[model samples]
Target: MKIQIRLVLILFNSCLCLYGQENPRLDSLLNVLKTQKDDTLKVLTLEELFLEEFYTDPTKAKKYIEEGLELSKKLNFPNGEGFANYYLGAGYYQTIGKNDSARYYINEALDIFKRIKHEEYIIKMTNALGVVEYTSGNYQKAIEYYNIGINYSRKNRHWDNLANRIGNKSLAYIKKGDYNLGVKYSIESLKLFDSLNSKSNTLQLKIHTATAAVRVGYAEMGLKNYEKALEYFERALGIYDGIDDIVHMGHTYSDIGNVNLELGNYDSAIENYMKALDIAKKKKIPIMRGHVLINLGKTYIKKGDYEKALYILKEGLPFNEQFGTKDNLSLNFNQLGNAYLKNNDENQALVYYNKSIALADSINAAEILSDVSLNRAELYYDIRQYRNAYLDQKRYQFLNDSIFNSKKSQQIEELRTIYDTEKKEQQIALQEKEITVLEQQAEISALQKILLGIGLLLSLIGIYAIRQKMKRNMLEKEKVDAELEFKKKELTTHALNLARKNETLENLKSKAQELKDKENMGRGYNQLIRTINFDLQDDNNWENFSRYFEEVHKDFNSNVKTKYPQVTSNELRLLALLKMNLSSKAIANILNISPEGIKKARYRLRKKLDLSTEDSLQDLVLSL
Candidate 1:
């Protein structure tokens, strides 16, 4: 009996050692995977790695996602293909602009997630789908997805994840103009975050709460809340410092600045805004920077610095136009008009104000129209246009009354509740049942009146904004043309000087080619010159060329110095041109090289530089 027991113990020990060995093998496999070259192999390795250590490496998570995308298409792995598409769509959709294909792919992923019954993947897909809906301005649909995500996370006991989903849902509510509900969700998320001891998440919740507070007319409370928000953000800033989180940080600063502006702290607002602008520009985030610029312009306007306000607005305008961010542009134009009005530039002020009013209308910003009407009334009052002023004031009062009346607010709330209830019941199949009820006379009458007013305002605003932009663009073009004329004369002079030098170099190069023993060599020279010209013309290509060349010659700095001891960098460039067999003219045209200079350079290359007679100067340099 003792011997049998001993044998059993030995066998158990052996099995335990074998399990340990297996774990290290898995670790080793992942280590080797980091060095893998094949996309399929790397992608597979990433999948395995994620299963082992996904929480530790989000960057590697993204790498796996990208690699899996490339490999799935190659291997025709439908499951892998769908998952990769879903994650990539999620990643890109988290940003500002909306991509329809990403939304489509995510929907496909949702279907796949359902078919697979993969709970973890299903949760991720739903969350991503919600984000896509939010970005596309389908706030109610986004809220639905986020609610689903929150429920799933709660079921799974994923407290941190549940908190994030709740926060996302709050943002959707805020977007839908239900700030009261948004604040509730945000505060709930904050409680969860505090329980989890997640300071970052706590700060995020505070920011969201403060933003909602400000939007909902609790400005003083918002200001106090934002100070707390900024403290947390600053802590987060410290942790994220020296990292590539420029956009998020910029946004944080902008939010802080905006809050400060509302609190009437202009200096603090300006400081925060400038910090945001600096980071935004450094990151090449035009939309974010443009938003900051527009806010800065508004701040300046409030400070009664009309000239400074105009300057900031103008600076933001081009970026807004370039990015097609009409929201920011409209704000800048409104501020610019206000600044101009303060400067007593009545005609320009009116032009800018009209433009702002039109743009606000196009965007269906009822709040913006309210503000514009009030502004126009104030302007008319100041100018002693009493009748016009009174008319404007009445319009403003009517819109305010329509929006703020308890009856309308209650109706909106009721509609929201009905929509939510119907969605929860999946009442789309009972469409006739729902539509028939809505067709009841009282509801129909209320909707008809509301719709008529909204439609008229929207249509008028849309036409006016479109026309304003068109007119502004035409004016800008005329100014651009005049500027271009002046620039052209200067550019022409520079071109002629380079051309003259190139003609001389081309003559010298032609003589040199005749002297060479090589026959097929001339093709190489032409190709090289064409390549250089192409590189110089396109900024994108130039960047690619630099990157490619650096990749090929990792020690390029040392190599260039060692190989071209007698050649200055400029002379080396000239030599590179010569190797291309470009006529001195082409080289001069590209490098601003003179013809007489090219001849002199060639003579020096052969005499001062050691070259075998059998080796052509172009051929020798080409080898480098």
Candidate 2:
């Protein structure tokens, strides 16, 4: 098989510590929720409790989310409400693997965050929305959302978050079958987090790096670099093993099993699967166990153990229905269908395949849908249903083509061309250097002949050689200096271009606003919004505005960027609001700053542009 099954984590990396007994963190949160006298604190604690249980205990997580939301509303606590909504969304997607509920709750939370001007959670919820799309198999759309978060994280110096989003984007590319880009981005992300961890060296950073390494492994797996994939998975496994993080450890074990399975090492795959199952049973995470069970069933099928495959797939079905996302559900159904088909249960197999297809279509899961279509078509052909079989066969081809299409092939070919060109350039440069060396040597030989008659021949030749060496060294230094300068310029330009595209995509995303209180909420959320009142003002996309989608208002805020290219989105929002003649108090509240803070911001802006006191900051901003 060219394909391998993978264990997917959430958009953000969260840890679940499973103790042999009751978890202290969960117990503490439960105690706080029941006993805390502070109403607002109680609401916040409930949200915390939800996070603790979301992975292992979905029932409790849902209960806590409901309790948290109700109480936050009672106390009018916007922060409490925002977090409560956020986790409610996360639980739906991460725990249950349902996109409809997940999208609704995540969008709701995003709205709340925007309203309250919670910049951090706003970006986080945005990332969460991307995760929902990713699990739904909207890989390209997911990458767009991830890019927004990545760019925002870079500009704001949120290195940890930047790493997370970059890893996520890498996964999207892998799923989209852009394995080269997947490898490219994952390595960059791993290096970035590694550098950051060197400075912090925290346990959290270690976990982050481990999560990141797993993605790199997945990218390698996509590229069919099985050895490299195994290497990364083992490295991540080692980290999780050291931390005793059984949930993550289970994932890494399964990843290693996948490599062995791909290599036709069935016995090794089973061994690794058993190890993962042992951890899964001990920790009792329904979702993780479901994945392991399904994967084990696939291995059995590969081994031609049809009866065992059927049994395993059936056993995993309930757990998946209870905890898996739509992707997981579709996959579970597809596996069951496959097991049944292999076992000669044609009637049952067709039923399961239909179920899988329905779920896949609902979520636009091209990969799963394509596989199941082909599976069902074969069964239909076997049962003498020629017409139905033909239709399904056609569908399979269409979906497969859409996923592994010519466009993606062309893109990869383009990247290869660029890499090849750069390599050729380097080769040419090396040849030029070689020619220079040859010329220097010829000159030395000619000098030796001229000095042959003198007793000072050896000394003169030595002096000439030393001087040539010095000249070469100086020339090399100059070339290195010039290359360094060029590289610095190239890197800066690349960064800005990426940021610009990210901002443009973000703007396009938020063009449609459901919230009506635009003036009350203000447009500074994109800059920074921190308050207890969230009315949600859409402060957003520009060049793509002509493509049938328009912002909520028909203002020319988009034009400001064109006029002043130096201004960032965050800075542009401030300038846009001032140009609209909003009050200082309103602007300060929207920007989550005091009046003095605004003054300082304006002063800093002036300093950034090297403006004297006489030059108006407002005028400079308005000109943009």
Candidate 3:
């Protein structure tokens, strides 16, 4: 039994670790897949390959999964189809962060697992759903799914499964800010891990237990129990060090630093944060490095070391931007704002404060929003902008109240109580169902009749409401159509007026040029006429006309240019004039050129566009 449990633990953890390791047996598997005639073995090999490569190369994993899915369908193998869907979902979830697609494929796998009564796969699929919910920020829903898995594992005496589920639930509770429950579940998980005896499994369990301890420490920190948080973090760090888990050791150090910072031990906080930063850099973990930098910078600010804070924060800003986690980005910006404010650079401080608020509001990051809003309110007050200060203060109060609400804790406890009561009721009801079956059937029959009447009445009202909505939609559409027609006519009138104005300028330029060429005119008079002609032919006039033309026919130039990349700028202008439905003579007049030149430009444009002689350039430009 111990050996079997150890194998199960290894398999579960191996799923996550496989992507980081290169498999020597992968070549053998590929060889067998290429030579094997059996579709079942091929499908299995494909699933193995996909699982091995998903985190490292999701595109390759996707190709293997697609091939497996096709072969499975051809072979009418439900189990093969199910595994293909499951891994495809895992690839999307882990690599692309597409929770919806992940959920769809995972639910399909769940259906197949349920139909086969495969209890182990069903538990795995349930856990995957919990992960999807956690990724999407549905912490309560994630906890509910984790609880369901935990209950199943408990009933089946799956200790390893129960420990994993409890650990996951602790994380969800911590993320949701229900620290008491987080600590409770983390302790329970540690107790479960204590019973496992296999060497390899024991080490794995220790890592999981350490992770839970870190979470518990974080929960304690959130509750302002710095001493307790420090104790738990130190315990976690010891375990991580024992197992040589440098990644988690670094994280625990950072958490300890946070607790120390909250308790006003700035030096200790900075020391621990620098230790974590060194580990993060050594391990090439950008997100961890970014977070540690922010914490260290905040510690410097607490110690009134504004120069140090600003330098550390500026160094960390790029990492936060690359990490793209809005909460951390917002916090980084808020810290920068604080550093600038302390340094008496009000303009820079205001800029960073607004940037922080924008990022916080985009992600609805309430904790960061509350802190940044309070800082901004203080800045505004300092600047004597009392009206803005009051607005920001009000925002800070609202966000702070939401973040630290006592009701949330009470609500979480009430939910747990309700869940426990419901589970007990279900067990009791299952045991006594035979005795009360007939009585329950009669009650259900009467309730069904009442529900049917209510449903029918709702259907009638829904039909009436839908019909009224359709009538209103039709009227709105008619009004929109009328407005569009009026706008189209107004646009055409504006285009015609522009064309006539350009034609009048061309005629005045022609008369001026003729006067300049005459012998009767004095040199001064000829130079004035020449200047007037030059103004008429200025490129600024063309630029102004092009802007108005774009407003009316936005896609005309772009469509023509895209199709004819070799066409020159002069050709594009000719196309635009033709698109306005102007004749050759009118276009020549506007351009201050002969009609023959306009004809030659059109011919060159048509050739560049590769239009046949039978196709009219004017028609093509007008269509464009």
Candidate 4:
């Protein structure tokens, strides 16, 4: 059994290694595939070849998987078709980073598995769903699917599958910041692998154990247990070294560097990070290179080498922007800010900090938000912007607390779910025992059984009725939301129309004045100019327009006035026009002022609002 498993592992790794640069195995595989006459064998070979390039060359992997899928469909091989779809989903997710497409393909594969009642593949595909959710940062949903997969694996006594699911759960916990629980699950997975008696599969078990160790190390790092983290990382490194896993070895080196940096072993950290960076570059791993660059740049910042830090960080920006993970991008931006700040370039620091915050907010990355907010608050304090400093400090505290509480809540909910499931299972067993005993009772009457059946039917009918009511309520709520959105659009359109008409009247008055000036001493032209000027300056028309504008943008004028009480009425009119997104020339024509005058008014408005040069007056007005 152990020898057979070892051969399987060798074959799998050999297939993957075929895609490695300078490998002769790829040409050998292609030669063999070309000579193969059996369609089934050809499809199987294509699947193996596709997995080889799945991560390293996704475009090529996709072509191979599509060919395999087409062949399987033509051969009416449902199992082959399901596997092909699964790999296609995995390729999209891990290589191309398209979670939606991944989810769709995985679901399609899942349907096929379910239709064929393939329990083992169903469990694997369910675990794949967890992986998709994990990549999407839906930690709680990922945990749910992982739990489901684990339960199924356990019931089927599939120890290897169970270990993999547990390892995945550990990763999800670590990502969610429940370091303690993550460590617990990692240990549990290691124990399970240790208990397996497949001597022939010892290498496979060792690989699993090594992965679990790395997870534990990450959890320890998250928990700030640097010593424990180093121990686990070293252990994992040893295992990977034994297997000649250069990729994982590179990752472990970076992990060690992070711990060393945190412990203030700056020289050791730099050395380790440089080693990792060298490996990444040699292997052409863009993501690893980006991450190692960030770590190196941050280490330089800590060492007070601000210029070096900035150079390194800026070099990493394009790589990170192109292919790094979102978290890595946030870290790069934040590190750039720190480097700039250390160099006494406060303006550049602020720009990078804002960029970091924007990216973090878009991804709802609470951990990144906590770190960036604290750094931003300190930057604000250093620049003597006390209000902004205070606001950012508050934001940091809020996010820190939220992250802490969310992790705690998730852990508690997981435990509660497990407890509930176990308790319900126990109750089900007891009920089964009771039913067995009741079935042996000959004294039970036929009338009692009939009444019991009627009671169950009535209960099911009540459940159906409640479901119907819920469906109606949901439809009603959706209808109301649609109506509200339509009304909002209608109001905005009406306000814009009124602004346009007001601008047209002002333009007409300007044209009439020009005509009167060109044709001097003409009583009829003079009278026409007077009429146009009266219409343009008409207070009633202004009042009517203001009323309509306020209705569309409720309390906008009042909000601005409340915020900047000293703003003059002319500035208020300027604000209104700005809110409509009108150009400077159009606003000047509408307000009967020159463009230069409008510019001066905008400057004054900025002063009254205490806005920096970076702030857009138009955006502020529109937001209000």
Winner by lDDT: 4
- Candidate closer to the true structure by TM-score (higher is better), 1 or 3: 3
Summed backbone clashes in each candidate are: 9, 9, 0, 1
User: How well is each residue in 1-624 modelled by candidate 2, as lDDT tens digits?
Assistant: 222224345344631211212245777777766778759877867766766776677787789878889888888888888777777776545545567888888888889889988888888888888877886768879888988998899889998889888888888877766676788778888898899988998777788788779888888987689999999999999988987777778878888998999988999999998898888888787767787888799999999999998998898899878766677778888989989988899999999999999999997777789899989988986775544664686687567547644444635453554356445655666566556655656666676645542434465457656766785566567545644543443333333332333332232224212121453533543322221112223222223222211222234456655655676766755664565455666566555456898887777667766789899877765554
Answer with 2 or 3, whichever has the higher lDDT. Answer: 3
lDDT values of the candidates? 0.59, 0.70, 0.71, 0.73
Worst 10 residues of 2 by lDDT: 544-553
List the candidate numbers ranked by TM-score, top first.
Answer: 4, 2, 3, 1
Estimate candidate 4's alpha-carbon lDDT, on a 0 to 1 scale: 0.73
Question: Whole-model lDDT, candidate 1?
Answer: 0.59
Q: For model 2, what is the C-alpha lDDT against the true structure?
A: 0.70
Question: Which residue pairs clash within candidate 2?
Answer: 96-324, 97-325, 97-326, 115-534, 115-536, 116-534, 117-529, 507-541, 508-541
The residue-by-residue lDDT of candidate 4 on 232-330, one tens digit each, is 989978987887767667777888898899899999999988888888787777767888889899999999999999999998998889877776788
Clashing pairs in 3: none
lDDT per residue (tens digit) for residues 1-624 in model 3: 001111112223422433223344667778877897758888988888876655335677799888999999899888998888877775545435577998999899899889889988888888878877776778889889888898899899988778878877766776666666667777777677766734345666777666556656766765678899799889978987987877667767887887888888999999999999998888676767787888899899999999999999999999889753667778889999999999999899999999999998997877778888989988986785544664686587567657634444444463455456445755565446433544444566677756754674476458646755775566457545544543444444444544554554454445545555674655754654465466556777578568767766768788877877788888787887777777787677667678899878877777778889899877777777
| Ranking 1 against 4 by lDDT, winner | 4
Give candidate 4 regions above 4 Å deviation.
1-24, 407-624
